[model samples]
Target chain A: MNKILTIMWKDVRVLFQDWAAVALIIAGPLVLALGLGLVTGAFSNSDAPTIGRIPVVLVDEDGGQLAAALVDVLTSDDLSDLLAVETLSDADAARARVAAGDASAAVLIPTGFSDSFTPDMATGEMPASVTVTVVGDPGAPVGAAVVRSIVEEFAARADTAVAGVRVGLTQLAGSGAVSPVELPAVGQSMAAAVFADSAAASAASVIRVETRNVTATGESFNILAYFAPAMALLFLMYAVTLGARTLLSERREGTLARMLAAPVSSAQVLGGKVGGIFLGGFIQLAALILLTTLLWQLNWGNPLSVLLLVVAAALAATGWGLLIASLAANAGQITSLGMALTLLFGILSGSFVPLNDAWPVLDWLSRITPNRWAMDGFVALAAGEGGAAVLVPVAALLVMAAVLFAAAALFFRRRQGALLTA
Target chain B: MTTPILIAKDLRKTFGDLEAVKGISFSVLRGEIFSLLGPNGAGKTTTINMLSCLLPPTAGTAEIAGHAIPGDTLGVRRAIGVVPQEIALYDALSARQNLEFWGRLYDMRGQALTQRIDEVLEQVGLADRAKDKVKTFSGGMKRRINIAAGLLHKPQLLFMDEPTVGIDPQSRRRILDMVKELRDGGMTVLYTTHYMEEAEELSDRVGIIDQGRLIALGTQAELTRVVGEQETLRLYLAEEAGAAAAQATVAAGDGAALPADGGLTLFNGLPGVLRASAIDHQIVVNVADAGEALPAVVGRANALGLHVRSVDIEEPNLEAVFLQLTGRGLRD
Candidate 1:
């Protein structure tokens, strides 16, 4: 509608009126992405940034089967091209090596690491978790990240093997292929034997994908590709929140009432505000993508897919912004909560660091935020997963948008009798 | 005479148990300035909000330019322009931009919207500052542009709800003149203000509102008539003389016998003087003839060793009428 467009036009013009805000929403992220890229050394003339094989020390504190087996994985053929592996008996020695910049990172396998992984029949702890500490030097950021990524890749494959065994054993007991009374003992023995110091066997019968594969594009994990979308999305929440909060500000300023007093309906006003935020977010995203591509020389593949991703990301973020605006009691609340949520989403979505190469729990938790979907789509594009590869994340983003929008609509209706400022 | 531009029959609005606008009604003839004269919290702004379709009445009905309220909210909104008590222009935008933005909302576009924006900017005398951001403008300039925003679409009826509340006198004067010009050009207006002088200076018919009800509605002459043939002669006395004069008069008894002496006696004996009361720094005389009583009052004050600092004579006004109706001063 003309009225809706008019409303959006007014809002957008108002948003652009403050040059500082425009700069903050657009250029701030561009600088951060580039700065982080330079910090991580994710820029180069090649299709991907190049870093030589990083020197890594593997410290096996636990002489258990899992620790020895994981150390074997660190020295495995798949990681040998990117990592020069060394054995350290003491974690302190490994830490000293990394701190001295003699090594990119040190992977310390703590005591009880494998003992936890082996199912305990008496303790009844079926799915076990143990912390694997990776200490990295600030001097070798990308190499350190790569070293850390390899350990996570090995851990992921082991987790898959254990989970597959548990599921199979549970099914067997249920189907009477194995006696119910013997299921726990059967699982404990199978797990203990599989991961024992002598048997370093990993299962292939379960669904698995190589966590990080150095593909044909000459690209490895680049920080700029990750941070560009991460920082952009982090501030995109703010820009959208800023836009949404103005609806309340305008209401207090009497401009909203004045507009409502005109030949305009409430729906038109909402359409304009939501549309303005949606469009502003997309512009910010596109501009950041372009600016990062130019400034950092980063490859964000499949232009069409990137555009689609930006739109979907904007939709999901704007929907959240509207939901926050509706639920927030005032402008101050919207601002503070928006900022807090942005940081939270950023941290949870692995914007600062890839959660994929970190804890599996955190990686799973990232799914709840739109930033995760957006980051996943962007990371996919960066890795040369063409247009169609991004569809799953885009679909995920749209579903989030639909859910958030429905909730926002319900809240808006409930609060309709009161003004936005209220 | 042809048809009323706006009419309301028993419009009511309640927020919880507190009734903001009681069941009340009035009509505005085409091309007339109908002023709602009331102090703050007398439901003036609430009434303006209701008539402008900014607030839906809890009960009753109304029609603006033949379009009904609530049921035809969009229609009513289309027929009216509302300049709220607050200066509602976007401070971030330019004067011209603010006008253009609001103009488009009223459905004007392209050259017509541009031309109308220019016309309204010029109308409010802000044509020169069209490009300057409104936040950079002076308060009066902002108020002018605020009014300019409302005038963009040239609606059939305009609602100016205390548009001159907090501004310099020069700007207030300009806005008053602009309101008159709009009415002269055949635009019906519903103006609300607590200032009796503003209502007296602008309205063809005044509606005196008090506590959610219209207490009186008539022309200036009719409203003034409510207080009767009365003139107040305010004789400002010196600070020391204020209490002395009143005590002197009370001692002199009834202020009618003249005390058979001189000094304050002459004030009691002044012809057409009905009652002389001194309070604070001013001696007020309710008189039958102000013109004839002024000289004698001043002479008596001088004779009584009371310095007549200044003197003022006021004709009975809507303030007096409001006092007679509500038993309290309008400003009270």
Candidate 2:
């Protein structure tokens, strides 16, 4: 135990002396967290109506009074301020525009739209409704819904005005002295008058939607939260690599053979090396977490759980490093193997990208990686739930660490005999 | 004297089918610097490693400091220290730190560890540079630290395998002197080196190894006597002495003429003939038996108008003895 502590102390001293290692372990995470936070912030605040523009397309097919009235309504300064409408000559062109994402939606008006809304037409049969076709990226459901709201309001106003016009016409006919020519002229005037009244009523009925996002928990996802954990894991890998490099250096310098010549047992030497690597990895993890918290306001809830996860993750990482170093004959072999393992495990662990709903095979493979379990624990803790749930994964990580460390120790002991002979 | 500090009775080690040490046996008495002198690939290191408990001999038993090796490896390790051929100090750590760390490994702690570290540092003449990192140290300084680390525990037996290879002349001499000093201070040392001079200078008794076998073992005088009573005589002749002049000079010496070849010829005993050089007018003669014939040979050469240059007569040393026994140079 004393020997292990001595080895750990030496490793810590070396880590503190290296400036580049300090920066990568601490500052790198904070920078990443800040950047991710700002991006999430920009995405959430995009729904405000402050001179912001939403692209829309106008498809007017009627070329008549009512179609013109609808276009005029859409082009008014008040609506234009919220939306940027591009006029398309035909429905086909507007659909193409929306499909290609050139605009958010297409408003189509049928031919003879004004005639369809007559008093006789309203009472005898229901007029064909003008369709507002919104073709949009399904991922942007909010934008599509906003466009639909505007069209729905416009339709309601048009319906009420048509009903009023039909009632007035019926009253005029009850007077019993109207001529047929005067009736056509009155119908035309009535149609024009109804369109104007409906436009006014629609304008008055326009309800501006104000969106307020509320969550039960007030936690905001920031860059620090997103990148702090990842950077911690990355630096943990680097610490392992550094420790492996030390092993190679000792072998090259023949110090390993000299150590074998001492009274210390092979097991003791192996234990010392593993302890050193674990200590370095722990330092890196702590620095990353602390820097992320202080610099970018990263929230790592349940400190005890986080601490446990970090320890498990460090052990697993250091074990992997020692195993690689033991198998490798030289520094180059150690480096190549270390890099391959780190990248393979890091990707599977979802350090760089989310793998929540990944393929079933990938999910199973991730369970075998300590990094995956560690990242899951961190994300769960930071998201403020699943405290007891994280214990299984953390234990799995520790088991993996123990298995790797044992394998490394066995390899080192076997090699010690060969090294001594050499 | 009681148990013989280390004993290897027919110790053998094999790599695959090739035997590195072939049933070699030797013993080191307490407080003696015993050397294993050999060329490259002569199993000297293999023997040392087995005795040091770093390797288990393939077919024989050895005891280190009264403890059986391999069976009681820990006991052997505790009683012995090893200074390998290669430098073994950590580069990142200071000399003091390295010593302290190694000392702690041997269970030396507190002020005792510090005191031992200081003593070893002073003995190796590295006390002043103890605070400096080993990477900044010279080859000799690193070698000294390597030796110091081995001595931190003050073991009864020390195994030094080619400890002075590729070092400066001064450092090599210092190390040789230190080995002698250590032996004098009551530590049994098994020193191995390819350099015949180092073995001849420092070893109380030398074991000459070749082809994984001990070819010869004895004191310097005892080994030199192996070449028999014949002495080697060298004559430093003037450059102007032609082959004929050299040949005539050898014939004139009071030794039996054997053959006349190259620039000169050898005589079985002494020749009574002389010839003079053209430029310096000098004559040189070399004889196999110089002691009985030197005075007569010198007189005859001077009477025959031959100016004698210089003469040296000495018995065959280890180098000659080795060459005669192996039909090859000691270094080769």
Cα TM-score per model: 0.77, 0.66
Write candidate 2's Cα lDDT for B1-332 as tens digits.
34588888899899899999998988888888888988878999889878876778898888877688659888998999989888977777789988887887788899999999999999999999999988899898888999999999999999999999888998988888888889888898999988877888888888888888998888878887776654544344554445434556555672344222222233223452121112133233333456666776666546544456876664666655665456444554
Which is the leading candidate under lDDT? Answer: 1
Model 2 misplacement above 4 A:
A7-219, A245-249, A353-365, A406-416, A419-421, B1-3, B229-315
The TM-score, computed over Cα atoms with residue i paired to residue i, of candidate 1 is 0.77
Candidate 2: lDDT over CA atoms?
Answer: 0.69
List, residue by residue over A217-285, the lDDT tens digit for candidate 1. Answer: 345656677778889999999889888888688887889889889888888888888999888888888
Model 2 residue A122 CA deviation in Å: 47
List runs of model 1 lying over 4 Å from the truth: A37-50, A55-81, A87-221, A350-365, A420-422, B233-309
